[model samples]
Target chain A: MNIIESITKSDKNISDYKSNLQKISLDKLRVNPIPSSKNEIWRQTNKSKFYRFLDFKFNNDFYYPQIPGNTKNHNICRIIIGENKKIKFKEKKWEIKELEEKEIYNFLEQKIIQSDTTQNWSNLLNHFLTDRKNIIGLNISGKEIPSLEIICNSMTNFLNSKTLLVNIEEETSVSISQINIGDKNSALSISTYFNIGKESVVNHGIISFGNNKSHIINTLNVRQHKNSEYILGSLQYEYDFARLEININQVEGNAKTNIKGIQITKNNEQISTYANISFNGPNGFLDQLNKSLANDKSHSVFEGLIIVPQIAQKTDASQLSRNLLLSNYAKIDTKPQLEIVADDVKCMHGATISQLNEDEVFYMRSRGLTLEEASKLQLRSYYQEIISFLPISKERWDLLALLLKDK
Target chain B: MERKKEIKQPLLEIRDLFASTENLTILKGVNIKINPGEIHAIMGRNGCGKSTLSKIIAGHPSYEITSGQIELCGKDIEPLEPEERAQSGIFLGFQYPIEIPGVSNLEFLRVATNARRKFQKKEELDTFEFEELVKEKLDIVKMDSAFLSRSINQGFSGGEKKRNEILQMALLEPKIAILDETDSGLDIDALRIVASGIKKIANKNSGIILITHYQRLLDEIKPDFVHVMADGKIIKTGDSNLALELEKNGYDWTDEFINKK
Candidate 1:
């Protein structure tokens, strides 16, 4: 079926849900008409190749995700194309269930209809394309869950999209991990929205391990309430083409946000991270650290923007991007930007691109380590800061370390 | 054992060595021979090529050996790389040990020890044995067990860094140990402790070369021979009293002595 016809038919067939999935995409398409590579947001990233996958048939029938047998989580969400199945082994403090059609419609009408249209065009496009596909809603209230692992997997030539809405109640704490695994020629997109309640704590990690021929895109939109805290740790490795756009808003005063991300790309892989955090209330704080390693002919791009308005007095935000270029042909483009209209704010941004330290290599060599061993040691250290900050336990770090060693 | 080591052969010998860096000569036709069971103290003023000599022996890549021969255990080792030289039993205690951020001290020690063991064709020590060995060596420097998990010398104080260098010396047990200004920037207590550690590690199978400007370190561990270096060459060689003379009268006598020569 054609892209427009398929989406229009799905919109009609939906039972009682006024799915804005196609409306937003159609509206944006009517306004912008076509995706433009000249746009500032897409300047370093090319989306022309994704147009072909855009018209691919959206299939809702596929095999269940093959998660590792040892993967354990109190709440697990598995998505394949448009189908979703959630298995909850324990549900003491929170409820995990499929979002009703009426609930999904009310959410879109209440949240997206009144938002500024020109701000997040890409996110609107993402939502329009993925809203009616598959969704899982989490209602957490004053409980601490060990971890929730969401596995997204697809085979070759498949098209899939999934969404998650996490409504964290006051004073609740939760940890969530999103792992994306895909085969060649798969096109996967995910959108996760977090409504963090007052005085709540949320720790999230996203590990995207896409194959060499797949295209994956993920968008995270988080709105934090007063005195709430959100920490996000992410790593992306071996993606043919991937983009992660994270938009965080401190809707109330005294909120805290921390983000740590590591991206390792080799060969022809291209990975990009765009994070924009806005402090709307007074005393909102943000700390972001993004480290990327690009080897061979790979390309890594990072753009972090922190906006503190005039009302956000006493805001403290720091954003830093540290990138490593291992080979002569590897490329890294990083921009850490700050827009502070508040006079009483402390804001700092820095970007660094460096190769391995020669002196460090010599020092290790003098201690009898070979050149390769010394290089590996530096790489391991480069990721230690991010890995240590991850909400995962210490015993699980060895698994991540072993995965990094393979690269 | 001492007499046998002394009569057998010199542990390290520099024969008419000439080395330079960036087209500027540093060590000009220098000759020095150090035998096992001997402690040779090389005292020199600033820019006298004392550190250069130690680095050249360690095969630092910045310097060029225009004409020189470094023999370790009666074999020419000038052609080997720095790591090869290290595995061949040459260790240089840097005046400033580099701070390797991110690598823990324990992991660094284990990796270095394993590399040396692999080079020697000896069976590698597993984690348990290596941890025990590192714990034993940590006491030699009076270092706490907490330091094993920290990054290597990332935030260590001057005395602590020196002790870590000595700890590596104890772990590697090189045949020719060149302490290049290892006593610099150390407190009195740290100096005594470091000197004592060096004495404990020095044995009949290894030769120690103490490179320092102050005679205070020698007060703790007396050297059998003292050499005064000036203008890229060793000018005067004497007993331990030479260090006291230089400490009392300064290096002016060496200039006059070189002028007369």
Candidate 2:
């Protein structure tokens, strides 16, 4: 109770934006863990030990994660030593800054926040506004962002307090890979707002492997102009628990979005992901796949919802989650749901959980491999399912491979 | 730490072995014996219990050995698990090798070698030493080093997958190797390399049980003992000439021999 209320306490002046956030207290919502006999999300969730643990809203102090045994080789962002620590970006035409409250309000008034309801999770995000005005935002539209690298270097109090937002202008194509690193047990509530112009494309890459209890809640609000495209790659491998909520809406016809993500969980760690995509126009498409491997007592959860409105004709959406449970006790909860009111829309979803085949093991042993070796071999193959589909980068693939598998 | 037992005893012995699946018998009252420094070939048409007999010896759980006595090096081994028998040097080259999509070939090799080595109370190889050890075995199957990093058979061709089986055989160096139809789908190049690799590893301290449907592989490995099997039992036993005759006259000769009996 102390952990989570502390999160909501960061906000004080909520009456100003009460109209934006639904007229319901998030803490008081009748979601899971509440004293309700019926639970929607837990209908299929194996909630024996997790029911009690899920109520843990937010704790003020989570022990600083032991610097991961070896991260000397992880391929994340780099940190510079000086004061004007020049931030590096894979894409140009963007600038970073810790703006004052006035600057933040000015940007908001200019329609820089493209998201509608996805960014409304915090009833009062401005309440915890310390570096609330800090972020790298794009100015001009119709320009292409090669591959932006947003560098986040923290001081001692990095997560004790701070928040930031990244906004992309309309009609611009920007690609960014944010690297978050430093000492504090940082809890970052990140929100992204992207606007798509006619026939424009935006590809965003996220490679997070830093060692810290990073509480990152990402909200992506996208508007698809006619014939526009949006592609996103989400990469996460290290954390006690990383929760990412992605919300997308296709506003016009002939637009599409392809989203792919890979996550690796080990130890007694946990990872939670929520993706809600809706098509509001005709002739829009969504193709998404998310893969994860949870070993030891590590737990993984993925909930994907692809909604096609009644007027959203000719929409195509497909989603799949493939999980490999390395240990008998390790658990993966995957739910791919399609809520469609349009008869002409094509939407499908599936989830599968299986252990390595016994016949395959014997076949490997026949080649002189021991049972343990056979298991390792099968595990390597499981992780390769995602790495093989990665966008052709040898260094990233090698680094991810090492982080994914211990042996 | 590599213990060497006495070589005078039978390397493998299966007596009155009746193996089954779902309580129905597939290997009925079969008996076979193989000693060190010898090569035995089992010839039969499809569905003759050739693969079943090999799986039974390797401890495949699906095929239950209802009533039998199997001895390896003069000790009863029917009760041991598949992994236990592997440590004791019983290898089964499968007809269709399974693809393990997540494991790298090199990691698989090191784990297997170390498991057997651990059984023999030997030290396991470190990464550097393991790399060197794997380099030599790469030549055994004429495979490239690039395969070491790739996932095991995730996207390998049929031929490459089979060659991988041979590569593993050369690396582990088991004492009793059972090649179960290793030549079933290989072209001439793969078949020649696989046959040569098996022959090179066949020394006086080891033995091989070559199970095949045709005499094509017999021409390469040159088996010393040829046994014809039908209806889950070996009907006749002879020298290498039996394989040539069976290749020419086919299984009809076996029917004539059975009628004469």
Candidate 3:
């Protein structure tokens, strides 16, 4: 059966509130066809690869999520999605509680129904496929919160779906690391939402990778209030097909958003990122940098958009997309765009695609480094800019070593 | 009784070297020879193929050798890759050292030093040992330790970059060191420090080639032979007096000398 048919026919034991939303999403998916290359957003996407993502059977069997090894020593508050139905952590400084039904309903009404209109396909698909057991919603509040690590995994030959919602209270500061791992020939669909309260700080990192020929579609939505700050660093690699969609809104302006993300693609893998940020009030600020590295016959894509309306008079935003084409056959598509109706706003966008500098390689080679060593050094240098921005500790995960191992 | 004569093989030798790039001849029938303990200064005008010759010796891939032979310690190195040539004891300090962002200068130095050591079959130094060794070499250039922590040449000034080049030379200790325009961007104080560093690094088992246009550098680091190159060929060979004459007359004198040849 097709993916949509299978999801609709599956036994979905969820609350009435989520069931109603799922029915709406299922009807929407039934009417509208799957997006193809003719669509502007999916223009660079390979349709057959995406069809393959939808070809897997819905996984019903229980499987344990394999947590990364190094998280044990860090005293981090860990949550493994698909392993638990309800999670709660309370400490002296902060508390994490599963969101009540009313809170989820309010989130759907306020954020999802309002801002996410045109590009709601991924969210709709995720909502349709994710049952109550697969959804994790948390309301986090405190001044000195412990670091949080959330992990999501897909089983082999199965299509898994998961959703996460986090609401940070006012004056709270928190750091969260989200890791998504896909098994061989598996597919995963994930939807993540963050609501930052007034005067709060959120440092979030998303590190996602997959085994051979795995696929993933991830969507992230964030809403920031006044005097709040939201910083996101993401890295994705080693998937046959993976796409990340990020939507951030500065609700009342006077907030800060900093995003740095990179996607590395090798062999026949394809990875893409689409980020959109909008300012609703004045004095909103955004600094976004997206990078991609493509090797072998792989493809990488990046598209970033920043919007400043008339009310956002003092909004300042900059978006840059930098890409590295590591092989002659490799390909990269990058576009950084800005839409500003505010007369007094400052907005800039730029994109660059280049190969490793030959002169730099020759310089290293002249210093007794072999060509392979020199290229690896260059790759390490290229990956360092984004890797260093990640919120995770280097000791906890040797990201650079992992990135350079195959190269 | 006739005394026994001692003979030494040349550390570097280039015979009838003809090289080109993209159908343009850069080095045409060029030749130079250097023995141990000798410092050869090649002075020429801009675009006289001075830098081209240095790049060719370092085995830059852009240039194709139509015909020639480059020997390191009497062994032909023409077929070696750039790294292979470097491993075989040849070092070429760049004219404008490439700046690599996000690469630590200390780590780059350590890797390069270890590569040379591995080629020489010497034990590789661990991080602590390498740091100690690098600290000693940093003193030669009078550089601060902070530069080591930064990206390779990334925010370094011109003089610092040149000193970094020299620091690399000091660490690698190649048999033949070809420094191209190492004095171009240095102030007088930096020049004194760098020239003295070169002098310290020079030993009886190695040869140095200083490519420059100024007689000022030649003043600080005396050369055994001064060659004037014009149109890809060394037209005149003399001692320190030749540099003084070049300084006095500029490269205009070399035009007449070339005509005489």
Candidate 4:
């Protein structure tokens, strides 16, 4: 399939992008063979379970799932399912557009397509499978914009991918949330790239829920400029198999990055999370916290790495991974890696794996709480640290509460 | 020379209690009776099993009562669970309160209060009414309203944690309150406030059993009887003057007296 010809035939607004995408579509066709368990990065996640679904063709005749009513908040809500996309605004103050123009094409081509998108198989597949009209662009400046929400659903047997490019202009702040809910027997992937301008702030949240027999993958790449701040809070709760990879690069001095994530898996499910943060300038800062809970023979993996180069002096970075194994048969793999080439950087990492505390349970029980009530309280508090970082709307909270369901 | 006369219908009674943990005996044939409107301070040295007695009474799962009977209001509560014992008007103010990272103090108190109320077949308070009730009890410990919003004792100092214990005691209003070493980590000012808080909650229908290592707390809150426990058994029982005598003479006198016997 020629990607450029496919995109050009779908929409006229992106006719100019067809030629540019033509230059990269040939490179996207060179698929990296599916990684095997022998590979170090693929050791924790068994890739054999996903190989049979790799060559699936797009299912265009399936029903486009409707966006549920609970997701319609006071903010700007956009629903994207297959080729049908709709955007509604309650109070419009920000810019929302499609990335079919010249400037966005240049940025996406240079910074994303020609870069390490070649190395990631999911990125390569996304580049080949996704239409250019499926890309959404958001820009916020000089205003307090409400949270922009995107609800994505995949009813196809093959990959249903969407890309979001968000830019926060100098000294502005904005929040974005992307939710993926897919049907069983479908495979989906979503990628988001953030361009944080100087002294601006951006808060991004991604939540993915999949039914049994579903496979999903999500990727986030961020570039932060001088004095900018970026926070990524995510909850990946349900799936038969899922993986989330986040890469953050500090482009200049004094940029900050905060990442918080929670992953819950049960019933033979498997979930993996990878977070890599690099400091390229001096006085950069990063704080990353990730937690996972696995039960009933399930498996959960968390890998966090922070890199500080010599030019990035006085970088402050800390990463901690806390995991809980509910059943004796459950498995959790956590490793926090810190590679520091700078002489003056302050970086530390720690990982802890523990069960529900006996003393804490007894304490609650001594206070008249039954065993079930006590355990429920402890479990709720376990995720409160990350849940509190989510957006404050009732709808968002309800979505966050899904993390604790059936625990 | 004589112990105070026992009131009718004792609140808590332990008859010939013998308990141990993991085959190591801690309490050897301990016996005591506490009645309403009275404060009994059990004074002992380290390893004399004062805390073991408190834990056994509270039904801590770690300890096994080899042979004993623990009765509340003349009914055997030996087979009840810890929460069951608690809902039956027995409160154990922990010597070291555990810090729960995410459970708010307010929510814990509300759950505990409702659990007891439900056990007693009473109506549970709604959120607004429960908040009002908790606010009134907050004054008993002189605590700031901000502490209620925080995780239970997550970052509390030693004194603040002790005050929180007292605040919970005030909220539950248990018929029998057993405070184990509530005076250990307190300064004099905190000691005064905590002692007064205990006093404020103590009433004619409720009894208090205070376990302490010092007579200084006895100076603030006088106990009706001071029992000297050595090697897990009460060797001497006397009036309040026995606490002063023990503070002046120390446990050496008890060892000498036991050696002579």
List, residue by residue over A1-407, the lDDT tens digit for candidate 4. Answer: 22223433534444444545533643544333244466545678755545534534553343556554365445554545344454434345455444346756776667546654333655555554556666666555645776766666666466566666766678877777777876777777677778889988888777776776677778788999999999888888767788888889998869988888899889888889988888999999998999999899989999888989999999999999999889999999999999899999899999999999988988888878998889889988988887777654555356545555666
Candidate 3 residue-wise lDDT, B168-243, digit = tens? 9999999999999999989999999999899889987788999999988998998889999998988889988999
Off by over 4 Å in 3: A6-18, A109-118, B1-6, B257-261
Q: Candidate 3, residues A1-407: lDDT per residue as tens digits? A: 46845544534532433566566566566545365466557888877888899888876355777765475578688888777756888989889899998778667545444433347678878876777677788999997777898988899989998889999999999999999998888999999999999999999999997889999999999999999999999999889999999999999999999999999999999999999899999999999999999999999999888989899999989999999888999989998899889999889999999988999999999999999998888888888888888888887887888889877
DockQ score of the complex predicted as candidate 4: 0.70
Real A-B contacts recovered, model 2: 0.53
- Candidate 2 global lDDT: 0.66
TM-score of each: 0.92, 0.71, 0.96, 0.90
Of the two candidates 2 and 4, the one with more favorable TM-score, higher being better, is 4
Minimum summed lDDT over a 10-residue window in model 2 chain A is located at A21-30
Clashes of each: 0, 18, 0, 0
Q: Could you give the DockQ of candidate 1? A: 0.76
**What digit string (tens of lDDT, one per residue) describes model 1 on residues A1-407?**
23444434534444432565556555544455444567656778755545644655565455676654354432343333344445343466665445566776677655555544454555555556564546666666656565666667656787677777777878988787777776777777777789999999999888777765777778889999999999999988777788888999998759999999999888887889999899999999888999999999989999988989999999999999999999999999999899889899999999999999988888888889888888888888898888777765544335356555686
lDDT of 4 at A195: 83
Give the interface RMSD of each candidate: 0.9, 2.6, 0.6, 0.8
Off by over 4 Å in 1: A1-20, A47-60, A72-83, A86-91, A110-119, A131-133, A393-399, B1-5, B253-261
Task: For candidate 4, report its TM-score.
Answer: 0.90
After aligning candidate 2 to the native by TM-score, how far in Å is the CA of A171 from where it should be? 10
lDDT of 3 at A230: 97
| Clashing residue pairs found in predicted model 1 | none
DockQ values per model: 0.76, 0.39, 0.85, 0.70
Alpha-carbon error at A215 in model 1, in Å? 2.0
